[model samples]
Target: MELSPTERTRLRRLREQGRSDRAALFAVLGAGFVCHLGVVLDGAPMVVPTVYGFDDDFLYFHGSVASRSLAGGQTVCVTVTHVDGLVLARSVFEHGVNYRSAMVYGLPRALDGDDKLAGLRVLSEHAAPGQWDYARRPSRKELAATSIFALSLDEASVKIAEGPPGDGDGPDAALGLWAGVVPIESVRRPPEPDPALPGDITAPAHITALAT
Candidate 1:
């Protein structure tokens, strides 16, 4: 259950954390929307940011067939992160972040036909749970124009940080500084529609539900 060296080094508190925890990894992946995918292109490493979806055993990404980042024949390193808050300690040196992040390393397989369609649907729904079903599905030509890739969830790791900073009760404790966590969260706002649409038109139930 050892985390890969590359992934493990990304965290500052490696000694204080364990990266092989599956529950921690899944939590990070479940809370994120965008993932940065790294692949080799022309012998150079290329990191592409895209929306992704993941299950227990696989990670899915979709794009146009013309996307070289996905269609390239190389392994990929994908990372998803959710920053929950900023922990401000009495001393700047002890300032830290409350976050959950996951990194997965694997080769991607281009899905064809039915699998491709299903993968796209999964990704879309993942980004917006009810939006996919409430919106129009892809047409035949649309499906043909798209490409979906799936990565096995074999090699991966998760790192997490929570609660207050380390300086809360350190030498800086008597510094008389106001220190605490500035909690951060992502919230979905109400959807705005085009002005040209009918004045009587209202938002879909799914769109209205986004306020939650």
Candidate 2:
């Protein structure tokens, strides 16, 4: 789908190279495990880190209904980002970061009953890949104890800034400052099973590949 003119212009870097398609957007969302949920509580803005998942059109977040950040039916903004590297150049002003990020703006729709249970499953799977299927399903009472919200991706933007710094070979290079890229990565360690669990327990495939 084509991005609105406003959206295209809003993202400074993306206006030139960022993608504005459903496929690109979904790929970013799938790779992300954490999202910053921004909500307006009593006219104040609050951003909370939370787990989230998404299909093609809507993104989902699950939390306690009693959460102060999500109380009532307040509007929210969600953002997910990956810091790829630190770009160091001869000039401090040219120093920057390489990253991929997405911003979502919408009102959260509360999910209850079966929908809430399914939303939780989606969240779990997104955070841990195949672990959702390997784990036991939630009981009816357990489902009732949790709350979930679905936000449409009808209005959002994806922004990405990548590649080497522009000052690497410019006049600023004569300054003799060390200039290079410092890559950042996220990795997961082996699972630490509970001590009370049976000794025969083994790590699942999802738990094994989380270090990426």
Candidate 3:
């Protein structure tokens, strides 16, 4: 399935970076666990950083029941981005960052009961794979205190910028300046056990494997 472009989603500038394929959207979303959720609160724009997870159809996020940002039934824009590298060009104007980004727009629905629990599980597993089953599940009271929301993935857009600088053939190239891509990557370090945890308790295989 291809992404349907709405007026807000259509890329007017740098159209070459825009991606209409659904797989591109999934790739951008799957590469990152954090997302910025944009909404209108009290007629003012608000953007909140939060952890999110997604399956085939919906993106899920959770917050305290009292959190004004998570109050659903209204349209929201969720964005995930991954910076791949820095494009150092001969000229400052040509310098840019290589990145993959996805923006999802939809009206989020508040989840409840089994659906809510499933969403929480997806969220947990997305952040830490296999830990959802390894750790204690949320109790009924805890579940009641949390609010989970699901936003449809039907409306979304993806953009990816990569490769070297784009000014190799420009007049600036004759200026005798170096231009190349400085690669960037996110690395996972060894797990640090909680100070309060007993020394005898070691990090589980699932958690330790991430550092490798």
Each model's lDDT: 0.77, 0.77, 0.88
Tens digit per residue, CA lDDT, model 3, 1-212: 89989987999898999999998888888777889888877778888888889998999987453257557357889889899999999999999999999999998888899999999999999888999989999999999988888889988989899999989988998999999999999988999989999989999999998885
RMSD of each: 3.1, 2.5, 1.6
Most accurate candidate by lDDT: 3
TM-score of each: 0.85, 0.87, 0.94
- Per-residue lDDT of candidate 2, residues 12-85 (tens digit): 64376566776667877987778888777667777778888887778998656325666576667789899989
Cα lDDT tens digits, model 1, 25-101, are 77787776688887777777777788888777788986443257657667778888888899988877888899877
- Which lDDT value does model 3 have at 85? 98
Ten residues in a row with the worst lDDT in model 2? 5-14
**TM-score of candidate 1 versus the correct structure, residues matched by position:** 0.85
- Which candidate number maximizes TM-score? 3
